[model samples]
Target: MDSIEPRNIPLTPGVYLFKDAGGHIIYVGKAKVLRKRLASYFRPDKTLTPKTRAMVRMAVSVDTLSTTSEKEALLLEASLIKKHRPRYNIVLRDDKQYILFKLTKRHEWPRLTLTRKVVRDGSAYFGPYTSAQAARDTWKAIQRVFLLRRCSDTAFRNRVRPCLYHHMGQCLGPCCLPVDNARYRAMVGKVELLLNGRSSELLELLQQQMLDASEALEFEKAAELRDQIAAIRRTVEKQAAVLGSERDMDVLGVAETSKGLALGVLFVRGGVLLDGRNFFWSGLGLEEAPEMVLSFLGQYYGPQSVVPQRIVIPWALEEQAQDGSALPVMSDSLGLSDEEVLADSDDPLAALAEALSELRGSTVRIGPPRGDAENRLVTMAQTNAAEEARTSASANVEEILAAKLGMASLPHRIEAVDVSHTGGRDTRVGVVVFEDGKPAKDQYRTYAFTDEESGGDDYGVLAAWMRRRLESGPPWPDLLLVDGGRGQLGAVMSVLEEAGCGQLFAVAAIAKARSEDSNRADRRKGGVADSIFLPGRMNPVSMRAGSPELLYLQLIRDAVHDYSLRRHRKARAGSALAGELQRIEGIGPSLAKVLWEHFSSIRDMADASEAELAALPGIGPAKARRIRSGLAAMRTKA
Candidate 1:
């Protein structure tokens, strides 16, 4: 390791990286002034924490990336930390985007749908709901009240008859019915108002509309409006109101325990507690709180993330002096003029707010709690964070498994793999991930295999998956659990050994229990306990039937089993659709694929008009007529 010269570092604002002997970056930090910050790290009188001292000893060199302003440095630091995943940085591991209610208002008959990703495709996104079930419940309520279109664009364009929802009066069936544009647009406006948390205004409008309908002797319409008003009221009442005025903001709280530090965020929309999220980092202390808060804010509220009008924190957003040393006073040796030093001293908090405001396309205020209501919200957030920390400390399922199963380390990130197929057709491999004893659904993946690749065998499927997994590389699982016995475990180990990754992670397999006498799987409840097989082990590991470790593995296995089966069925259905389409005259493999891409089901294709068919690439009027006739003839025969 070599000492970094403070004189050589720039006095300008920038981000710095500390690299170890192997040239691997272990830490990343941003600074108001690079020279002062780097000097803080190397000062002899400064009292460094054990972690900081260890990092400095391991570092061989430091690299600086200069930026025009503190804001630019902040953005660059977050980006580099995310890309390189430096060891010392507080990396937010959850990459899953929040659920949003997307209203496709650009369509003639707009529909509301749930999505995890947001795009600029003329759709209005309402939420970054932490709970998917809550978003779906709201969406369902809107659909019930508004009777907006429930079908997708393709389904709406191709349908010749109304769906069951239209018959049940849950939808207007704009797909098949001649609905008035003004009426539908009015309903859409009401939905937008409701989703925007302007429920009071919407209720007033609905009440006035109901009165007008009653005055006009339109009793049915009046009754419908009355029901709609009631439903909206119920939904609003379910949300606990914490303020008199409609204010949308997020409150941050911090909790520190002997185990770790936890940060909690409470989302308040229109003065109501919408939801809350908790993040915990074991072994982190209050001393690291400033860095944690900044890093979390930068990573969590990224581009496409929802930014509220205001953000309330438990404390001031001020930088802490590193290693008990005050910021270095500007000196001639540091190579900075007075004007340059003044320019670099811009407030970090203000810069952060400006960056967030730019992302939100509006002003974003960041500060401590302003009043009693906000203080209460922050207190609640802190309570939640503390409770989360307590719960996390109590739940040591991974540690228990590591000890019981003789694993080398705690399997914090476990992935279970299962292969699904029907009689060696449409083989698919599903992978489910568990992080810290809970499902990380966003990391779950499914891989499809053809007969040529997998040879219609479980071993072949596992091998193919292993090769692909190797190519994808790192963030590799701590434990790989397969849904089979010794043979499956052997197959996975062989592939990993061949690729020189056998020791990279532990491997195991699960097998259903069989009746000892009959040698058949018992159907009765608690008839037999399942068995687990470890790599290079001759027999199953013996354990109680309902032990937590066994049950946890079973839970992961069941998830992958269900996931893989669903994917296999979906593949088969797609194959059936393609087969049916290719049966039509003047349609081949390419044309069938194109048709499938446009229409999800054969019924949609059958219901499509000749003009629609002709509009498809490689299909002109003559072929369109031929294909339409062929489909009609096939329908008649069926």
Candidate 2:
């Protein structure tokens, strides 16, 4: 059968490898004592799963990576496992998607922005904030607090006019105006300190700035500064202060129920629990107590993003902590000696057995807490794990949305459309998709109106786009959303009915408020109150704000607006280019195409000399002179 044998290597602190019968390294383990530790796997199984038995059956040979101490071995184990991600090991897949604070470091006045991806090429980064809303709020706070530059590099370099951001008090207009480099760098340094939990220092500086502004009779600016300082102070005061604990510490707690196992981690940075997350895995078969804990720790700490000064785990991880391959241990409380702290003599089965027995409503035994403090911490860990599990369940959302909206389905997929243009000048349509209550960006589409009556005919633009979409035959959608009230809906419904596709999907229209302004901040201001006009209903289904359906509806509308505006802007640029080229006597559609392809842009064509224009494929010397003259005339007018 399985012909694997232990190397019987001395347990003088080293890394060990377990190879399957086929000589594939199935699992790698480490221990302080070479002989006594490696021999424990052969003992009678307590509650090992079929998977563990299978792994054992495949074990053919053992290998070791010798080290001077168990700590070194433990260190090495974590490194190798991170590199390999062995099958038998626990894998914690934490969502890496987080908000990033991007700063343009190359510019003299770097702009601060919130982005999803971080490129670490000398730019400053702060965050991985839990939510996009939270990130946006923080960004707004930063702007009010420190008026950082927000322009793009190209805009900053060539800007001649102060933009709207300057008037709104959001940007300092450093792009066009000169700013002292020393002062700008100082602000950057203060941002670094503020993010690093030195809010006290930042507040002091803000206080002085506020005083300076007030004394200079800049009352409005001083009031704004005061508000910003208060916001920063309020946020800092929310940080939880641990009793006599160092600023940096990672607290680990493990809890298990019949449903699965949970590892709850509390990361304390600068003595504050800014954020935390939970990890859970199906506990099908758990044989060795230390090994299970070891496996979970390996997966949890594999990422380079988070590393703590000290770790507090439930059980000893000696074999794991040795060769820098495992979870490093600051200390262990078991009766094992200082040297044996990293040894494999400790057994946790008795405590787990008692806990499981109690959980099963039977007599059980467990390790007594060293003190009440330790016991309370353990309970807190268990509560945190349970809460994390409950919060992360995806099933409840569907049921909740259904009950709230009285809908057959959760309305997981929604399609929204908005038509954009000024007086139908550049009539363009935007289509947006929302899936599972969020905007599904990849499914967004846009349509530029080919035929439309000039000046304010919403129905005409919508009808054209609708007809084109039907003819083009894009993916059929779960729902069709119209941005206008009755007019847009009537046009869309009529087109679909003509195509014999009226009953193929749900159609609804969201109309803006008639009396109240559409752009107002008041949620209730917008109308026909965002009424959902169903296919047959002469009116619309009205829902209250904060309802899940209402929230989902708002997201769809917003996404469509964003898409429509972006498409409209691009179409406007294209139209402007075409109109400019059309003015040239020699530039018909063919000559326009040649000029567009040759120069790649309207600006380039306009900037080109007569010689460069003559060098183009179809432009003769006489035509080039005409082209240059036309461009010169447009530039003069502009």
Candidate 3:
């Protein structure tokens, strides 16, 4: 389908995109010599990596956009990749799936849900949590400290009776009961206070309220406040100041292996190390240190990225660490290849900083950290990256297997897929990873189906999920292992075909043997065989259950199932409990949701003064009183 002949192409600097049959852009690139680069794909005798061949095969058309110079083309290519996320442009993507806690004011009970992106929607999003577990722990603590509903709108609507969470005292049975809207709103406030990292202010307010209640002879209210104060203090004491300055900055450190380069970003906010992230880049020929560093800076500081006035690279502090000794001696220790020598006309780092400065409407500096304390911080970031790359040296797994996987070099990364659901509800896809035969736990990601209708369709769920992931692009695995038989394997292959990156990675499927002639007793003992299915094969490749390849596949499958199943159960339970708040007479679904977002719990919502309740739209003075009366009745029932 690739109909364009290379001879027809003009020699010029420009960016080009390869589009699939559906007119979807699959790959984006830039070329100083368009004819030469375009001709390389058509050369029959020239050796082509499987990845390049795959792109060429699926591409039905090539669309070119000419630029004035190569630098302009380079910048345009980066921007297009960011927008289109063509699968081949892996060097600039950071799709690590950090957790973001979302609380929407649109709901009556604004319970927290972990989301991936921070949208401009009115809801508040707190965190770039390094892992889902960290976000889970924070959400759990918030629920434990303040009993907010953990159910979804759908679950809340269908409840006939209070669920386990309500009985366990983690939620007030707002559904199927005469619930208090005002009290629920208060619980939402407490959770927000904790998430906003205003624990000290929260503690002071609780203390003041407790004192007020005591003076009013409300002993029970005072006691509850006292406990809340203690909990806040315990949480606040755990976050120690990690830096000497309160100025916010991003610290960058680089680690390199012969195979690839890794960059560690330490997010320093209010001088506290809140979260850390690592990004990897390879195969764009970033062999030279300066070019790699510049590329990293450009991609990282692009328009959408959050930026501070100053950026610190570890090598910037290399000289200071040596107490003013020459730069070269310190550079080597920091994994920096050479002194800050500028050989090329294109100053990408400067261009990046300039673009950032334009966006920020202020000058932004990209260089080393300034003080003794700052220098130590940069060193810390560098060390973190070094730890990640230490294992990268072993990223080259068994070479034979890598070749089979159709990798350009060796398989440094492998991602396994598993989908778990509860009766077409809360379906979640798990993307688990292994690097050089060892687990990469931080990279484990799960995507829950947001559509209720798509729960039962595993093939559809996976295809859609994989497509979205690839479109976000990068950190693409060298190999893929689907947790099913040929059906799932074929589904994955078809998805890769649609994305135009099928030949880039090796693909396989793992399936448990059918009973065939075996009895129930044999099945119970794990006597059934495991099958490994490779692409282009009619039947699964033969491998014994005890074989290393089969066993490793089993481990990956087990982990994905476990990881996804656990989250599914929790989400299902939460969705069921959150629906309860809508039962309040004065509040409908929309009002209930907003109230949930605004207030933390039933008690908080019920205790809110009439004036405060009136401030919320649609809740007039009469409805406010009704809300209070309902809360009082619910209080009596509980």
Using lDDT, give the best candidate's number. Answer: 1
Tell me the lDDT of candidate 1. Answer: 0.81
What tens digits encode model 3's per-residue C-alpha lDDT throughout 1-638?
44665445656768788988867678886666454445444433224444566777888998888877765676787777656656554544453346777887778766778886655556766655687787787677677778776777656765689889989977887876777888888877877766655565678778899999999999998998888777767655756556655555678877665545677888765555667877655543332344445545655554334456677876531111111223332233233322221111233355556666775567888887777877877777777876776654344334545544444555556788888886777888888887656677777888878756465888888887778777766556767888877888887789888767776567888776666676322222223387778888887676666755556667777777678878777667546534655566777777775666677667666666676777897889998888777776776776
| Model with the higher TM-score, candidate 2 or 3 | 3
Which of 1 and 2 is ahead in TM-score? Answer: 1
Q: After superposition, how far is residue 532 of candidate 3 from its true place, in Å?
A: 5.6
The list of candidate 3 runs beyond 4 A from truth reads 1-94, 105-111, 147-193, 198-201, 204-218, 234-238, 244-250, 279-367, 391-400, 403-407, 412-550, 554-638
lDDT of 1 by residue, 1-638 (tens): 45566567887889999997656678998888887666656534355555576677778999999999889998998888766656677877665688988999888778899998767677887776888888888888888999988877766777889999999999988887889989999999999888877888999999999999999999999999999999999877767878777888989999887777888998887777778888877667787787788788887887767788899988886545443333334334575444443344445578788899998779999889988999998899989999987876324677677776688756767899999987788899999988777788978899988867766789878988889988876566778999888888888999999977777778889887788899885534332498889887897888678977788888888888889889899889988867877888799989987887888766677778889999999999999999988888877777
TM-score of 2: 0.48
Taking the tens digit of each residue's C-alpha lDDT, what string does model 2 give over 1-638? 23433333564767777775544456766665765455445433332355555666677777778888665566577666644434455533342445667777776777788876655466655544557787687778777767787765645655678889889877767777676778777777777767666677788988998999999999997998789888787666766654234344456677765545676666555545655556665543333335666555544442223334444566444333232222222222122333443346354233333323433234433233334544454466657976776665432444454454345433445678998887668777899876544565756888766544525678877777788878765334546778767778999989989987775556777775444556643334333356666666775676775665565566667778878988888777776787668877988877776776576565566667677788888888898988888887877787
Candidate 2: where are CA atoms >4 Å away? 1-40, 46-51, 58-87, 95-97, 100-128, 152-164, 212-221, 233-239, 243-246, 284-289, 301-304, 314-316, 320-381, 390-638
Top TM-score prediction, candidate number: 1
Q: Sort by TM-score, best first.
A: 1, 3, 2
lDDT of 2 at 525: 31
